[model samples]
Target: MYQAKIMALLFVAGDQGIKEKDLADLLEIDRAALRQNVEQLKIKLINDEESGIMLSQYNSTYKLITKSEYSELLTKYFKTGLGTKLSQAALEVLSIVAYRQPITRIEVDEIRGVQSSGSINTLLARKLIKENGKKDVIGHPNLYVVTDEFFDYFGIKNIEELPKIEKFEDYKEE
Candidate 1:
């Protein structure tokens, strides 16, 4: 039962994955209980011969990922452009990153007034933005900046080519 809920949360978390602490808090269970449930879920997925997905852990975050056996099929799907396109939220995040290069995820969230981890992950996966380095702040959060791919995607040679915010204000109705 708890394993099912954990799977649902991981699925909703997308590629960003979820931290163990956050997961435990959401499930209203202690860390040990969460770990036990996650371990069971991992075993269940691993033992299911027909299951194409598995739980993967990186550092303290956990994500549901397709097993390597399906790598070829997944590659073909992405090559054919069948992969999901960016959502509105992702575009908004991209815009923020484009204008504010070397900004942290927390800063982006503050500018947008919402959590942007999913969108940030999407942009990172798409190669539109990348972690330039870690900020010197307390947590040393990653600082993201537009990549060369972003230039190609936007058809702009440089960041300065992006339209000025004042230009948009000029078009606003009085």
Candidate 2:
């Protein structure tokens, strides 16, 4: 049953998925235990056809997503705007990625002057931003970019259609 709770959280995470290490940190359990939990959860879901959602594993990340057979219903929800709102930090990270895509997290943090891991995770979970790939730099950090969902959410036709920064510069108090 505890694994069920974990599955529920993963379901809420959407397509971005959560890393195995993050899941272990969240559940306060060791790596071996986390692996066992995930395996058990996978078996349970496999046995339940009416569950409508399935677990997906990729690059040591696990995501709980709806089964393709249910795409029609999910599409309807998307059309009806069922997505959650993002925090200010998420918006800022999204803007940085939108303008400077394929950027590493460190680069985004450098621009914002703060640790943006939380915001990046939130944006990824919301399907607004995605992992573009790893940078060639040291530690091979992941690069991020906006998804088509980003445009749909913002009502923009393309990335270039985003508002110009000069519009905000004109609002400076000085």
Candidate 3:
């Protein structure tokens, strides 16, 4: 019972996600017991229709994410005092990343017509984008891609569901 609360705390506090071992370590328990606690908590969140919270597993981490029904309330409750809004420049850089992900930072800078290192930092900090891996370029700059959190932000299941960006007639020409 108490373990569940601790598990929830670890899950919520960690931005990326929480692994089973971390939960176990928090409670100083064995794997089987920790797994059972997490499983039960997962069910409770799913079944509690009024809570508007759900457990998501990503990259081997579990996180407690708010459902759409409670987006506004949850956001308000968890809103960090830190200037929590994304800036216009960051938005432009995120759009470029979403459309051209698995792309290098230099490519993103080129599309935005500016260095964009600062904007990229902000986006990465916000979890809108993440390092996919290193590119094959000369310096092998890290590649970036929109994260699953981005889809959660937009309420979409996948990037393919993003509204299609239209190609201008002039730009479509050979």
Candidate 4:
């Protein structure tokens, strides 16, 4: 039960990842106990091949990621009638990422004036956006960008096909 809770927390952490110390602090557990639980969770994720998700460790941070083998199926599922749709918040976050790609979550939050963690998670799960890499800033925050799936969904050959921001100026009231 405790391990499952820890795993849930990690899953919510998403591509930004969570540091070991931060996880320990969040769980109110000692470092040794946290390590043991993380190891157990890793083994459990590895054994649950049907889950399509896995635990990943990068520079002492842990994140939940989709397995490579499931990529084709995921794409097909999205392409087909999966009946999935993005919420308004998700669309807002996607637009920000599409326009200001390689941007950090903090920057997105600053722009939106609210925490967008859940919406970002949704975008990632739908493969509309992905973590390009960590920014070279303090804490090395993850940089996000639109994925190929994003282009496919929007019927665009490239980001260049997206409408320019200046085009919206006509809609602005005097």
Candidate maximizing lDDT: 1
Per-residue alpha-carbon lDDT of candidate 4 for residues 37-102, written as tens digits (9 for 90 to 100): 888888888899677787788888888888889889888987887848777788999999999998
Backbone atom clashes (below 3 Å) for every candidate? 0, 0, 0, 0
The TM-scores, one per candidate, come to 0.75, 0.54, 0.50, 0.53
Candidate 3 clashes between residue pairs 3 or more apart in a chain or in different chains: none
Candidate 1: C-alpha lDDT: 0.92
C-alpha RMSD in Å of predicted model 3 compared with the true structure: 14.1
lDDT of model 2, residue 64: 89
Between the candidate structures 1 and 2, which one is better when assessed by TM-score?
1
lDDT of 1 by residue, 1-174 (tens): 899999999998887789999999999999999999999999999989999999989999999999999999999999998785778889999999998888999999999998899899889898999999999989999999999999988789998899998888769576
Query: For model 1, which pairs clash?
Result: none
Candidate structures ordered by lDDT, highest first: 1, 4, 2, 3
Instruction: Estimate, for each residue in 53-152, the C-alpha lDDT of model 3 and write its tens digit.
Output: 6776676566777777876766676586455667777788888899888888789888878667767887888798999889886898999999988888
Q: What TM-score quantifies how close candidate 2 is to the native fold?
A: 0.54
Question: Which runs of model 1 end up more than 4 angstroms from their true locations?
Answer: 113-118, 131-143, 155-174
RMSD of each: 3.8, 6.4, 14.1, 7.2
Candidate 1, run of 10 with poorest lDDT = 165-174
Q: How would you encode candidate 2's per-residue C-alpha lDDT over 1-174 as one tens digit per residue?
A: 659767877875655578899888988889899888888888878778878877879889898867788899888887786657676778999999999998999999999997788789888878899998899978999989999999999998898899887888769685
